[model samples]
Target: MYVYDEYDQRIIEDRVKQYRDQTRRYLAGELSEEEFRPLRLQNGLYVQRYAPMLRVCVPYGLMSSRQLRKMAHIARQYDKGYAHISTRQNVQFNWPALEEVPDILAELAEVQMHAIQTSGNCIRNVTTDQFAGVAPDEVIDPRPWCEIVRQWATFHPEFAYLPRKFKIAINGAQSDRAAIEVHDIGLEPVQNAAGELGFRVLVGGGLGRTPIVGAFINEYLPWQHLLTYLEAILRVYNRYGRRDNKYKARIKILVKALTPAVFAEKVNAEWAHLKDGPSTLTVDEVHRVADHFVDPAYQALQDQSALLAEQQAEHPGFARWMARNVNGHKKPGYAAVTLSLKATGYAPGDITDKQLDAVAELADRFSFGEVRSSHEQNLILADVEQTQLLALWNELRELGFATPNIGLLTDIICCPGGDFCSLANAKSIPVAEAIQRRFDDLDYLFDLGDIDLNISGCMNACGHHHVGHIGILGVDKKGEEFYQVSLGGSASRDASLGQILGPSFAQDDMPDVISKIINVFVEQRHADERFIDTFRRIGMAPFKERVYAANH
Candidate 1:
């Protein structure tokens, strides 16, 4: 919830005007498609399969109710009546007219938002946990550091056009909800034995054609040198990262080619020049950035477990939702709630303008006028009072937001495949819908327990298929759509890429294939074992055998 200063506001306004002119020239035929490609990409406009898609940045996934309302307005006025939340916590309008994108950005700027750095081969949006400040087990609030990094990365002259797109993630909580292991740079805040704060830095982590769990480069990088160290890493990558081939241009490939030790050595050598330079963070500046995220006025209250238990007894449906959607809060009587966007038959992350407006109202009523977007393509109200849980649940249920499937099989994380993305080999939305229909029984999904089923249209891995407990990727063979399955991948603290399960299957067989995988998991699992735990305990052999036995 960082508010823009006068200077920030001016920069956004100026960029909007520049883009407006750029758009006018492009539409008037003064600029060809070749000439306009980079310019349009820098502003988050992509010419997709059917139309132009505009990706609007939601930095660190934070948005005010006012900002949410403006986004709803843009969706209603400028494009289709809906928008899709991406895996990086950004929002995408898949049907924006090429000429009208500037107007959409101009509207966004009025609410202190923009599409800057949402796309192209530059440092994209800095992301973190959806429950950054409010998580009960947090070691530090990451939003301040994320904002500091965002400011430093925005339009940094040297990194404006890297060898490839770059992503960074920061996690300050005990758990790794931010998926730090799968980003170009992952920072975890930690305190030393001497009681000084610093970060555990990981580098060379990414997911694409070549998926990797990042390697640890520094055990404890001091707090003051965060930006300086980052600059050092970028300097090394920009100098040595491949430009000949886009596939191998990412820092991960460079790190692999040089080995992590040599990569660290290069970064260390580069850091020697800039460690104490002007880019180093100061205590006052840190406080200045942090001031924007000051805690809300919270009333003192005892725990509401007894009252919640009574409500659970009164309403079974509410009880199921409470179990799935509600999370423990740092405050005594407050909780964080996830509003499920995966209503059956709809796209996993698609939200209509009407639902957006309703969510804005709900945020104001229960969460201090702020809302959060999660990497799992769900919306979060991070500071709802526990006493008002029943009322909030009732309202969300009426809005079709209470599906009680936060981490279950039905709560799928999928990308808009061939439907919107030109890069996709097959349509992911229909695949997700088919799976949802197959597993519609709430009892069945809850029985499956804490499964992350991610589907990506192609190997770009927009849906993060590499890290799902059950990962599904679409493939094109002989110009026909087919699905590939993988198992045991995770994006948590113990991160690992999934292992593929033999050959691809026809699209029509996807539902039964998933059911077969689940059947194997159920047969082999120990008591109370989650899908991931069972998969890990008993490798991929059993699941692979069961999945491909008849076909072979």
Candidate 2:
């Protein structure tokens, strides 16, 4: 993890002091609620349904064990002893007191962390692949670029107040784990035919009321020109992005209105001026940033064949977990473990203080004192030894974080819906829980295979329901809760927005409806095909026909 320098420290301290003063003025009656709104939001403090929610940024989803422990401490001391891992790979505390947020920011500053840019219409946290440096298929680590962009975008004067929130994601791996295609700006680190480092830039992709996959703006932008290119893109968006209506204010709207070609043309025109600007990255600076993300020292160990065979023989659950939750790592003996938060009864991304501490301890003990937060809202121990797999699973199981449901039907991605979010039409957590309960069988879920079940309380797509293989959107029908289903959505390399199934189903009918959808896929899929592949092959007609056939 990158250590904060004096400049970084000073900036956060100053921001904290400023927010503290702002809070005091609001409390003293000098600032009205309306007047104080943007000030608090800029600091990542939100007045939620019952209390204030503080979203703390975990830069590029990387955190030290000590930082994770501090987060656990914060959850214990201030909030409800738990934090919700957001879809953007940030940690959100739902019960932080509004007055104490500045204090919280100060504490976060101590750990080189802050809530800055976690919210507001400005550029938000820059996300990259969770397994950025460690992924086997990576051409270049994306964290350095993510960090560079993070600093550049933070409190940027030109874009401090955009018409809507801007998100940028970078992916360096062969697999698009960062969901780059759905971001306002997406960068995929690539190597040219000559083997030079560069990025494949994509723009105008976003998910919300109007979901659109980003289109390629540049096939190859040399790594040195990253910041310049980014500035150019932002300049175009700032100038022309919609401001009259919040719903259409995002860069995606602008991209849609202008088309990618015109958008790219405008960006290129802007870039001509910025091509050699101060913000243009230098080779030395890139290496300096990249140094912080270098692979940790690992012991020289061969593959643990005996240990794997033992795990397969002794523990079926561990075997299943290894199959679903473990990812290939760059190192020989190391594996990236996804500690699934989607247990049968728990909220999708909720982790208690105890669980957080356990994860921190596990990272320190088994991994390299580093942890990652996946965009799927799961905690990752990125460098665990294969020999310790069963033991790790046991510890995680005791803490309710060992669900063997990654990428399965039961592995649901959900938002803080009506239960906590004021914008939600219905509670999404309960819906996720209901569905999980309906599909608790491990064998059955494995049979269903690589299904992405995502739910959003509203059209904001906070839960990324638009890209789930089975997307569920909560709707209000005649003042009653209902769910609208979509199929064929995926957030991988072959990104595609889901198409909605027919009429919405009532809350009570949701579980059966989901089951029917799954059954249709199972009935129609070719041998060994995943839900997404099957849906793409057959389209939504088969699933839609089966799901709504009885009603029609």
Candidate 3:
């Protein structure tokens, strides 16, 4: 929601011009593939298996309805008729022509959007909780801080190329919906015993070939030193992170090698040089950025619990949807609705141009002309009035947006695996579809309760399979695709990497594999326990036994 000033506009426009020239040079053979690789990546263009993919950043997952319409236009005009929402809350067009990416970037610039830092080994798009300002349990609005970081990191010369990609996440709420511990840098607002506002910083947490939860590098970093401290962390990583091996180039590997204590000490020494630097945050600047994210015009109204109860009794289907898809809001008589994108038979997160346009209209009508992209690959209307919930539900259902499976077993988080991504060794979309079809019964899913079933085509962890309650990773066995399953992983406050069950299974066996795992949970779970809690209580032994027993 932060409007671009003249400086911001000029910079984006200039970059678009520069990339257009670069693209022209490459297409004309003035630049070879080797030379154009980094340039194209820097601009968020990737030459995938069949065609080029363009990833457009949605900073902090917030998009005005106008911006949404622009994105839909791009999807319709430039490439395929649909786009995929990424796990990081960005959007990806999988079939864009390589020659037309600059035009697309220029179009994005018109709406204060760009693909900068969406790829490349620079700080990627800064992310936060989708319900940042409206969450009842929010301690502070993180959008301001996220925006500040986005501006600072965009095309920063000092960190243009790091050893590998860097990610930063901020959580300002009691719940850790932002998956802070899995990021390269995680910032959580905390208050000292003296009641001073500051951040609790975590460093070097990541999921890939090697998964590690971040260590607390600083117990408390003052608000004024946020930028300065961040600079120090990046400086240390840039100087010491490995470059000899791409697999081990991430900051997490460096942190592990140096030991967390030594890494913390090194960062502190680096911070000594940056302390009181010009990059130090000022109270005025923080206030200025925060002002842009203030609450919209909200009408005063009583809570609509009685009316909602009546509607629920009247329409059981709507009641089921309301129970799963609707979330509590900080404002009275309002709700945050998650429009499920994981419908059966469709790839999770894939939204057509028509769907995007309709969503934009819905956002204008109900959500203060803004929409949010959730990390779970769903669209959010964060300010829907409770009085209009029934009407909105009906409209969404008609548009194929109301699956009523948010947080259920069927609301899977997945990536465009082998179908689009060359890095993927196996297909992810079909696996997700198979599982969704097998578990289509609404009553059965509700009984299963809040299970995060995430799938990744490969170990890059784009699907965040490492954090799912039931994690599935694709493996290539003798040039054939096999699926490996894991359990007990979570991305919440109690973050932990999933443990593998056993050997991999053929693609066709995934559904049965998942069914066995679920059977174990249902048999062993205590009253009111979710899949994650049951996994933690009983460990992976029972589930492993059930899955492997069938294979044997």
Best by lDDT: 1
TM-score, model 1 to reference = 0.99
Residue-level lDDT of model 2, residues 1-552, one tens digit each, is 899989989999999999999999999999999999999889898887888899999889999989999899999988999999999999999999888888888888888889998889999999989888889998778898899998889889999998899999999888899998999999997778999989999999999999999999899999889899999999999999888999999999999899999999999999999998898888899888888877788889788867797878888888899899998888888888999989988899999998889888989998889999988989899998888888898888888888888889888999999899988888899899999999988899888888998999999999999999999999999889899998889999969999998898888899999999888888888998998988888887888778878887
Model 2 lDDT, full chain set: 0.90
The segments of candidate 3 whose C-alpha lies over 4 angstroms from its true place after superposition are: none
Per-residue error (Å), model 1, residue 181: 0.6
* Count of clashes, each model: 0, 0, 0
* Candidate 2 off by > 4 Å: none
Per-residue error for 465 in candidate 3, Å, reads: 0.8
Per-model TM-score, in order, reads 0.99, 0.98, 0.99
lDDT of 3: 0.94
lDDT against the true structure, per candidate, is 0.94, 0.90, 0.94
Q: What digit string (tens of lDDT, one per residue) describes model 3 on residues 1-552?
A: 899999999999999999999999998999999999999999999888899999999999999999999989999999789999999999999999998899999999999999988898999999999999999999999999999998889888999999999999999899999999999999999999999999999998999899998888898999999999999999999999999999999999999999989999999999999999999998899999998998999999789999999999999999999999999999999999999999999999999999999999999999999999989999999999999999999999999999999999989999899999999999999999999999999999999999999999999999999999999999999999999998989999868999998899999999998999899999999997999999999988888888888455
